[model samples]
Target: MKVRKPRLKAVDFFCGGGGMSYGMLEAGINVLAGIDYEPNCKQTYEHNITGAQFIKADVFELQEQELEDKLNLTKNDDNLILIGCSPCQFWSIINTDKTKSTKSANLLIEFTRFVKHFNPGYVVVENVPGVLRQKKESGLEDFIIWLKENDYKVHFEVHNVAEYGVPQSRKRFTLIANRVTDESIDLIKSVERKVTVRDVLGQVNGFPEIKDGHKDKTDFLHTVASISEVNKKRLKKVAKDGGDRLGFANDTELQLACFEGKDNSFKDTFGRLWWDKPSPTITTKFFSISNGRFVHPDEDRALSLREGATLQSFPKEYKFYGTSTSAIARLIGNAVPPQYAKCIGEAIINNHLNAV
Candidate 1:
């Protein structure tokens, strides 16, 4: 006689474009709904994560009953999983203006509201390492202390997603809190080998050469951003498979005023990626060569939208809906690298998500 194992279910908060939800679903967990304030994500989330409903509402404005009505969640269900991978721009270590992120800094505390109300069996959060670095100011410390006081056996650590099946060098902070049982709880384990850019890119991986700004007819998203005349000449001078700004350090004519005085701070800007290594972290500005090592190794253009999404470990079939390139780039850059999320989900399920 075969006894069916009950499936673990989850609700994803701040689920941008369904990345986390999609991964959990792939790992055999039922993600009931993904909630977010951005209406731009609704279409993509609804289209991709079939079984999950996309609830467009601000976390601050959202009520407990609304989730109850939408997800049909019962209070104190030891099998229920709550995911709060909030947008962490506020806590990100990037040198962007802190004033812009000031308003959203307290989002982690807001996620705690639902955690207290539902008392879910499992709680998961993935964010930038800066969150833990600035735990006191980011509300991470308070949240961890509260979860511990509430009987949650918590495990947290920062890990590189490249070691977990994602072909990029992305370091993220992960926290898993479980109250269902006190027996055991552990952080997600990594893969035996790393996946690198060479393993996924090039003609063998379906990324054949296309000119800068060339748009593939079959998939519009498989297109690169157009560069200016001056930038085109600069890219042509770069070597394949790991060319960098240093190549033009002595080229007085093509060098920009910013780097002329030997001030080479953001040297990665306009750099080509190494074919053999994992790519640098993909960010919201991945479409711009002026952002990071975003230029293609074999091509002269910055990474196409699809390529950026691929490095983020999103399924090639995953459809992202946005009006413009920047909009779509933001959607792809701000994802959890579905592969890493799947690892987290697998860790929980394999641990059996014990009963209360």
Candidate 2:
């Protein structure tokens, strides 16, 4: 008789739009529920993930007992997993506004509340490297100390998702802890090789040529944001394959006033992506050509919603429902690349997924 592996289960914290939860499910784990404060995330999370509920509430307001009552999580249950992949981007990027990040820096602490209440089989965390850099304020240092105090062996490291089969350059910190065994866990790499923009974009990759403000009738998600007449002329001036904003610097009429004297300021902004390389990090502003290197390699417009999601490793079938295009882009941009999350989930399973 063939023996069946015991099913692993998880609860994802800060599960915006179900990206992390979806990846866990794909890794053969049953995601019980996803919790976040954004009410808009509920529909997307519940709609895309099967057998998982979306909890719309602030983690700061949640009590450990309430989570226990709701999920029936047992203390030190080797089959259970707790994931803490909160949104700490504002602090992660040094140039961005730090004031907003301070308010949510303590979210990792709220995640620890559940861990303290129920010392599940494993504790998994994925966040920007800045969290580890700012471990003092992010509560990461204290959390690690607590995990050690509770006899949990941990493995923490910073990894680039592009090295894990994702088509974008994303670096995140990951931590995995297991108390069921004395052996320390190791995060094995994914089987896939690194992918590039050439491997995933263009007409051959199901993304046909679409002009600025052009919306494919069959799929509205493939639409691009419109550009002004002057920006249109600047797009025409750029080189076809991999061009930068300097392509139009000589055009006195087209040169941006803010960059009149500065020759090499924000080199990546308003630039076209290179077809042979992985695209720049897909952020919330990817739909705008003015933000980052979001312009198409050959086309004239910025990336469409579907293009952004695809670059971020979201499956073609995954649908995001929201009030507006920008809202949906926010959902996609803020998401943890599902492929990267799968690697994390699989690593934990390989570590200490004890059979019941």
Candidate 3:
């Protein structure tokens, strides 16, 4: 029997829906394990990303020793990469219900605990912009300091997803730490220019019109209340092709959402997309045209789950869970766009290969 070489294996923590892992896999890195507290993702993660193992475990409960045994990874496994994109609902601006807890913010400290135990050669983290506001005395900052103190060369940036080929304008704080590096490398610099929504969605065909309360053949469509009779009539009056509400609204029905007062609320809403331009960020509620400027810009209905996922840079074949509108939306919105992840993962693999 021949002894095989060690594979570049990664363990994804808080790996909701496997977005990051899929990106890494695209870059030729082997993702062996995905760990998340959400038990719902187990089947989808396993089914879609074949050969990958989904471990539905809370990172907080396990001792690092236990994880080491389960992963069959020892302290000497220097090729290991630990990725943690912990839930950011606490810090997300969209999650404005103040009652939501900040318990997830401390997950970085848990990440640090794993670092101390395994001392993996590489670590990656992604989170919302608000996570930076955490006090210096808090675990967030301490984790940053801990990386420096431990001699890992860290590269972090709040990068926009569009910059890395994800058609959506999602931005995230991405950090890559390498224990083997003595000098810092620019992760952000190597990434190319932004990709637009049109870039990703233009080629996908076979999507049919989805109306509120009606399911498509795939059962992935979302239902928004049918456009009000008045709005429907108004939509009809507007000139075809990406026309905004302004084209048809009279002064009486012109009242805008409080947030969009004075500004043109109809720019993306009830609007058609320009083939040449990029798309706005795809939120979980992307199925609802009223939620943002997600209306097909041409079609009367909003984008379907597949369209939304495509705009978010997920490959056409990716499958998401949940029957409710909110469940599928959360999965798509929360995922790290696979294309963006692949770009970063590719760079990491190249660097690692050169180093090894």
Q: Residue 19, candidate 2: how far off, in angstroms?
A: 1.2
- Models 1 onward score TM values of 0.96, 0.95, 0.86
Q: What lDDT tens digits, residue by residue, belong to model 2 across residues 162-237? A: 8888899888898989887787776666646678888888889888788898764443378678899999998888
Question: Each model's C-alpha lDDT?
Answer: 0.87, 0.85, 0.71
For candidate 3, list the clashing residue pairs, or say none.
162-194, 197-279, 242-272, 271-297, 272-297
Consecutive 10-residue window with the lowest summed lDDT within model 2? 347-356
For model 1, what is the C-alpha lDDT against the true structure? 0.87
lDDT of 1 by residue, 1-356 (tens): 55556789999999988889989998889989999988989888998898888888899999988788777789988778999999888888888887876867888989999999999989998999999999998899999999999999899999999888999999999999988777555645576778888888787988777888776645437877899999998888878889888777778888888887764678888899999888999999999999999999878999999899899988788888888889988989998899888988988886764443
Task: Please write out the lDDT profile of model 3 over residues 307-352, one tens digit for every residue.
Answer: 7878877776777777566677778877888887887787777666
Candidate closest to the true structure, highest TM-score: 1
Backbone N/Cα/C clashes per model: 0, 0, 5
Record all residue pairs in model 2 with backbone atoms less than 3 Å apart, i.e. clashing.
none
- Winner by TM-score between candidate 3 and candidate 1: 1
